[model samples]
Target chain A: MKTLVLVEHGDGKVHDATLATVTAAGKLGSVAALVCGDGEEAAKAAAAAATVAGVDKVLLASGPAYAQMLAENVAALIVPLMDDYDALLCNASSNGKNVAPRVAALLDVMQLSDIISVEGDKTFTRPIYAGNAIATVESSDPKLVITVRGTAFAKAASEGGSAGVENVSGPGDQGLSSFGGCESVKSDRPELTSAKVIVSGGRALKDAETFKEVILPLADKLGAGVGASRAAVDAGYVPNDYQVGQTGKIVAPQVYIAVGISGAIQHLAGMKDSKTIIAINKDEDAPIFQVADIGLVGDLFKIVPELTGKL
Target chain B: MKILVAVKRVIDYNVKPRVKADGTGVDLANVKMSMNPFDEIAVEEAIRLREKGKAAEIVAVSIGPAKAQETLRTALAMGADRAILVETEDEVEPLAVAKILKAIADEEQPGLVLLGKQAISDDSNQTGQMLAALMGRPQGTFANAVEVEGDSVTVKREVDGGLETVKLTLPAVVTTDLRLNEPRYASLPNIMKAKSKPLSAKTPADYGVDTAPRLKTLKVSEPPVRQAGVKVADVDELVAKIKALGIA
Candidate 1:
């Protein structure tokens, strides 16, 4: 079997999620990486990414039409290429979620999202109901399109395989959509989903100003990514991107620190998989303490700063 | 211009779905069913556009059992002009759902299509993009904000990496994200008024779309629960435990 993996890259480097996706795809069959880009930079990134050990070949499409990787044009590029492979793989990133389903629909196949385990040639296990239940599905279709959660699989060894590169031409200028550009931050902090440690805040932080003041110092000291409970996000203490819950980004890092969070079941669905958990809440009965490996009952207003100072 | 919005009857977001002991699927008997929350935002966005004079009509739609008409009525109460229910009993997967919606869009000829990014139940964020693909229209998935002007739409999307924006022609699809807007509740009078609004029904066969599910459910079971670990006495103990776990 041959599996085709979508390659995601930025700043001329491959994303760790793409590497992990390759690892997961390797479990099914030999892998081919499809790197779609709008220019020379995307091509360079593809070349850099193709060296990951498991890839058997790299298919590069760097036409101007791919500028924003618009779901329409990108899915169009992928549909015709599906005839050569048995399965398609992509990280469960927003772009992947946006594109893969279109491909599945056009192929008249059902698309699987955020799959964690490949049970066999056709069966896979995935979480549903905000991680409360796991569902195992088996596809009857001849080909499959799957989006994988990066954290579930280990990254493939990048021991430098010399995979042959193949440039592919696509039907350009689909004219369905145009890119308006991205608003992104090249932050010193790690990306939250892949971060090893996370320090999350809740509504008790009062407001954005206090949230930053209390969460940032401690997070910076531990080099942790910052997260927020749904209540904190709903209270406008942080942007929606900072949300860590069933409706937001699901993370399973090494350590997760919750400050003032009451640990609603939805919040636990997102972070309960973290290897080590810590909680600091004034409410002694807050549900977060039930699963916390290290529970501190106190006021975060004073405790967070003191902990940061000591660290 | 007309805007077509699709809603789904899903298990309420607040409900914790229990897997059946036999492991076939989630037990939905006598469960509280509501319009998918994201679809409420979709209906709300369409109404806001009509209020702004960007849309002259808003048509809400759903595909499920007859009970789904309740979900559509909720959309009507929320301000949609009319609704269509493509009634089906089989479990509809996203691809089939997209096909059914495409058939509706083909007949409605709406300038824009809207839906929730994903239903909380299946959590498969697929229908909007798939409908756009089947119709050969532009798609803006995970939309945070939408602006309609002069036969075109611009959407700010909530992507994994920060935010990105896209501009598309009038005949497009846009999926709602969490931060799109706070959805409005239907007033009592509006609920009664919705009872009178026209809600037409059709079968999947009427649209020439197959309702069979492509994937078979082998089993549905509970995810492994995390066990409670040692609880430290204080911040000092917490820090000490972190050091001992080699997390610091």
Candidate 2:
């Protein structure tokens, strides 16, 4: 059976995570990387470039609506191709998560999401309770759609082979959902999951008023995305979107810096994947130190300012 | 416009969940059960729709045991007009739950359906989109804000980099995100009145939807334990250690 891997891209470039999903799909069978976008030329180029091992073909579905990623439009485009493949895979990205379920529902199949490891066609492992626990779930259902966690799999080999590209389009009403303009907070730092460095703050910052002063400057210096512990968000020190924990987003930056945060199990689960962890907390025995490669015992109020000044 | 909000009864978000020893699932023998936090956002949005004169009626449904009525009542206390409890003792997978919801949608003919992006327990985050597909309606998943204007609904989705706004026709499914709204707590008076709210209980068989499991939990294991590390004496020591590690 051939696996259909949905390759997502933006601004004429494919996301690197798609390569990771391609690697995971390799375990199943021959792979077909599908790039659906507005410009056939761009899509075809991306498909040709995705030289995943054992890839049979690169399918490109190009249209004006595909220019900007809309879950409904994307789902409509991919649903028709579901019949051509046995298993569907995509990176567990925000876009992938949004569209994969709709596609699964259309085919009346089961979808496994945020999967970390796939042992076989029916068996997979994923994190639960945020990242505090791991569960292995087996799907007995025949049809399957999966969103592979980007960090879970290594990047697939992009050299040594290429696939023929095909341009395909089908009937679509394009009336699934409305497309509203996107408001993005532009940052120079890498995406949280793929970033080599991450700077996180906790309730020790006192409030959001001082976050810009403490975390942002240091994060900017380090070129890292800003993260928050649940305690910080619960205390209204920062927005919930920034919270990192078992209930929040999980990340594995190369370097993770936790400032003024007592590491809770939930928080630790989210960041433990980082290659090197550094924590700054007043409490010497804070749970964060357990996982931290470097632990500083001092008031964040003092340490952060000093660190930022040095940076 | 009639609107339905799907709720799930789960362990309180504040509770540090523990997996059962047998790895069947989360241990819930003594843990206090409450409505999922994101579902609370859905409940609040539905109530706002009703208060704004957008929804003619609002019905909140939960799929779980009879005890889930408590969560439904919480929704009622928050302003849902009625409640439905689809009694299922076992944990219903997202797709199956969506199937049950689609059945209810066919019966209710609601113009809009709202639910949390995912139940905290399973973290599937699939039901809203699945239900939308099953019902042949448009879906706006992970919506941070929804504004209904005449026959069209404007939804603000929480994308990875930022927010994206989309407009969809009526009779769509929308899922709530963290910033959707601050869910208001049920007042004492409303809590008292919620006990009087109309609650209808039915079996999945009644709706001709199978609540059977599609996914099996082969094992549940605790996350690896983090070992304790010593605190460096000062910033200079920390810098020295970090320099020694060659990370920064």
Candidate 3:
């Protein structure tokens, strides 16, 4: 079977999640990477993607319309390539979630999303009910389209044998949608998903001011990425990107610190896989403590400053 | 312009779902069911558009068992002019659900189709996009903000690092995210009015769409549990433990 993996990238560099998707694709069959973007940057990304350990070749499809990764245009680009491959795989990232279903629908196939384990070329295991249950699913669709969770697979190494790059023509504009610019949260701290250490806050921080004042110092002291529970994000204490829960990004960092978070099940589903969990809350019986490796019962306003000072 | 909002009934987000012993699926014997939160946001957006005089009618649709009408009633009470329940007892995958919605859209011919980005139950964030593909219409998924104009709609979507905006022609599909307007509670008077509003029922067969599951769920099981560790009395002890572990 031939598998085509979509290489996700930004700022002219391939993302770590794409590497993880490459690893998942390797389990199925011979893997090729599809890098879509505009101009020299797209070629550069294709070069980076070709270095992934398992990729046999790189397909470069560059055009002005591919710049912002619009779903309609991207799906149109992938549809013609479907006949050459048996399965198409992508990281279950934001871009993947946006584009995979369109590709599946255009191909007239069912998509298996957020697969945690690939049992076979046609079977997989995924979480449902917000990770409360794992379901093993088997699909009989002739053409398979799937998105694999990055945390579930190891990142494929970039230092490897050179793979041939093939330049492909754009599928042309679908004329149905157009990209309107992007506003990204500028942060010098590590990215939340790939960060080894993460410091997350909850609604207890009260407002955005208190949240930043208390959380930033601890995160900076530890050189950790900042995260927020749903309550914190809902309260507008931080941007939605900082949210860590079932509905948000999932991470399995080496160390995860929860300050003032009550550990809603949805939030726990996102971070329970962390290697060492720490919870600091005034409430001793908070659900976060149940999953925490080291629990500190105290007021975060007092404990957080002290913790930052010590760090 | 008419607006079509897709709603789904799912297990309440607050309840912890349990895996059955037989590993078929989550045991929903006596669980509280409610409208999916994101769908509520979608419904609210549609209603706001109508209130702003951008839309003429609001039609809410749900695809599920007979009980899903309650979810439709909730949408009706929230301000939908009418409701359509595509009743089905069999398992409906996202693709089939999209196909069913496409058939409904073909008949309704709404200018805008709105839906939640994903249902909390299956977490399959595909229906809206799939429906868009089936109908060959533009889509704006994970929309945090939406602005409707004469011939097009601009949507600010919640993306990976931050926000990305997209512009789609009229008669597009939009899926709501969390940052959309907060849904309003149905007033007592609105609840009584909703009971009298028109509700129509149909089945997947009516659309000639086979509502069979293309994917077979072999088993369902609980995730691995994490055990609780020791409690530290103070920051000093916590720092010591972290130092010992060498993770930080």
Candidate 4:
């Protein structure tokens, strides 16, 4: 079977999730990559994707229409190219979730989303009910569209055999939607998904000011990415992007620190894969303690400061 | 201008579903069901638009079993003018759901179509974009904010990196995100009024859409469980443990 992996990139570099998706695609069969963007930067991204270990070839589709990744045009580009591949794979990122379904609709096939394990060429395992249960599914369609959860697979090597790049023009503009600008949170901290150490808080932190004042110092000391439980995010202690839970971004860091978090099942689903888990909370019976490799029962206000000072 | 809001009846977000012993699917015998949380946000957005005079009417649509009428009634009680239930008993996939909505959109000719970014049950996150592609219309997905003008809609979408703004022509599809708006509760009077609201029911065959399970479930099992570890006495012990683990 031939798998076409969609290579995700930004600022002219391949994303870590794309490398993980490539690893998932490699388990099925021969793997090729499709990198879509505009101008010379897109060509550069395609060249970067060609160096990934599992990829055999890179298909580059560059145009102004592809820049913002409008689903209509992006799906149109992938639909015609689907005839040559048995399966189409992408990272289960925001862009992938937006574009993969449209392609599946155009091809009249069902999409297998957020697959954590590949049982065979056509069978896969995915989390259901907010990650409480895992469902193994098999698709009978002639072609398959799938999105791979990055946390479940290891990243494919970035350097290996040199694969050839082929440039092709994508489908025409749909003229229904246009790019309007993007505003991203400017942060110097490591990204949550790829961070080696993560410091996450919950609603117990009280207010946003206290949340930042208490969490940032410790995170800074450990050189860790900051994350939040859904309760903290809902309480406006942090932005939604910092949410680490079933409804938020799934992460698997080397060390995960849960401070003032109760560890709801939703939150546990996202970070249970971390190598070493530590929890600090005032309550000894907090659900977070159940999963923590090392638990500390104490007031975070005092304990966190002391921990930070000691570090 | 009419606004079509797509609602889905799913297992209540508060309920933790259990897989059957036979490994078929989630047990739904006694579980509570409600309108999907994100779909409630979409309905709220539509009601707000109608109140602002951007929409002349709001129509709530759901594709599920007959019990889905309860979800439509919830939408109606929340201020939708009417409701439509595409009744079906089979497991309808996202592509088929998009096709059914496309048929409804063709007949209703609504100025805007709104839906949740995804349902928590399947979490496919596909129907809205697929419907837009089928109708050859623009799509604004994962929208945290939406502003409808005379001929177009401006949306602020929640993306992985951050917020992205996009503009789409009229008759476009918009999917709601978590932070879009807080949905209001339906008061007692509105609940009484919703009983009188017009709710029409139809089958997938009426729309010439094939609603079938495209994927087969091989097995359902619980994920690996994590065991509780030892507890430390205080910050000193916690730090010692961390240093011993060589993680920090």
Per-model TM-score versus the true fold? 0.98, 0.94, 0.99, 0.98
Candidate number achieving the greatest TM-score relative to the actual structure: 3
lDDT values for all models: 0.89, 0.82, 0.92, 0.91
Per-model chain B TM-scores are 0.99, 0.97, 0.98, 0.98
Write model 3 residue lDDT over B146-210, tens digit each, in one string: 99999899999988888899999988999999988899999999999999999999999999999
- Of 3 and 4, which scores higher on TM-score? 3
lDDT of 2 by residue, A148-234 (tens): 887778877666567887878855447766566888766666777677778898887888888778888888866778888877876
- Specify the highest-DockQ model's number: 3
Listed models, DockQ each: 0.77, 0.64, 0.85, 0.78
The positional error of residue B199 in candidate 4, measured at the CA in angstroms, is: 0.6
Off by over 4 Å in 4: none
Q: Highest lDDT: give the candidate number.
A: 3
Q: Where does candidate 3 clash, by residue pair?
A: none
In terms of lDDT, the poorest run of 10 residues in model 1 chain A is A156-165
- Give TM-scores of chain A for all candidates: 0.96, 0.88, 0.98, 0.97
Per residue, candidate 4 scores C-alpha lDDT tens digits across B1-248 of 99999999999988878988898889999899999999999999999999999999999999999999999999999999999999998989898999999999999999999999989897778899889888889899999899998899999998888789999999999999988999999999999999999999999999999887889989899888889999988888888887786756
The digit string of per-residue lDDT tens for model 4 on A35-115 reads 999988898899899999989999998999888888878888899998899899988888998899888888888999999
